[model samples]
Target: SADETLAHLQAALKRRRRLSDQAQMLVRKAMAYIHSHYTHPLTRQDIAHYVGMSEDYLTHCFRQELGTTPVEYLNRYRVLQARHLLAESDKSITNIALEVGFSSSSYFSRVFRKEVGQSPEEYRRLKQSSVR
Candidate 1:
């Protein structure tokens, strides 16, 4: 009974190890693109091309590993950067939007709300309030 239990545990652990390894490789490539060019109006197609896969394939891989598409990931990342600028920089929201790859402030506000549950202005208000 002890030997069987040990074997089962070992098998489970091995499966988890293999899955994590594969997931890490997928995320590593995705993040490489995100970090290097988050400011450059990158697209899912660009990431797919960089990784030598079709856009659909890259989307599937990203969803399997990160539970989201690359575009969603990048959008959230941009919103995060916008949050920082809102809190720390004198830049206007429009300027911050452009800085973070959003082509328009209105569009950035839309996506920011979708990802962050609030408009960028509201996020900044909350952040500023918390700091006081």
Candidate 2:
């Protein structure tokens, strides 16, 4: 009986390992898809469609794998790109927001402050002052 129980546990462990590997691969694929399409408006539905899964399932899977929802990940990525543009380009804040795929400049400002602890203008000013 002990040997049989050990064998069953080993088999179950193997199955879990296989599923974990698959989830890892799917997360990687979803991240790659986000990196490529983040410049455009994206939704959880869009990511699910690209990954060939339902939105609910993709959300659960992505959250489990990455500890954040896909939408949140996209927003963070957008903010990162916006930071670069803000520091280097003379583009308007609204333009930078739109270029980074935010739907509205106010929304961009809100999210940017949330993520960076500063508004885009403040960030740009700080960066420019430091460079001089």
Q: Score each candidate by Cα lDDT.
A: 0.77, 0.80
The C-alpha local distance difference test score for the whole of candidate 1 amounts to 0.77
lDDT of 2 by residue, 50-125 (tens): 8888888788876665556889878888898899899899999999999989999999999899989999999999
Clashes of each: 0, 0
Which residue pairs in candidate 2 have backbone atoms (N, alpha carbon, C) closer than 3 angstroms, thus clashing? Answer: none
Question: Which candidate comes out best when scored by lDDT?
Answer: 2
| Local error of candidate 2 at residue 111 (angstroms) | 0.8
* Model 1 bad stretches (over 4 Å): 1-26
Which candidate leads the pack in TM-score? 2
Relative to the unseen true structure, what is the C-alpha lDDT of residue 104 in candidate 2, on a scale of 0 to 100? 96
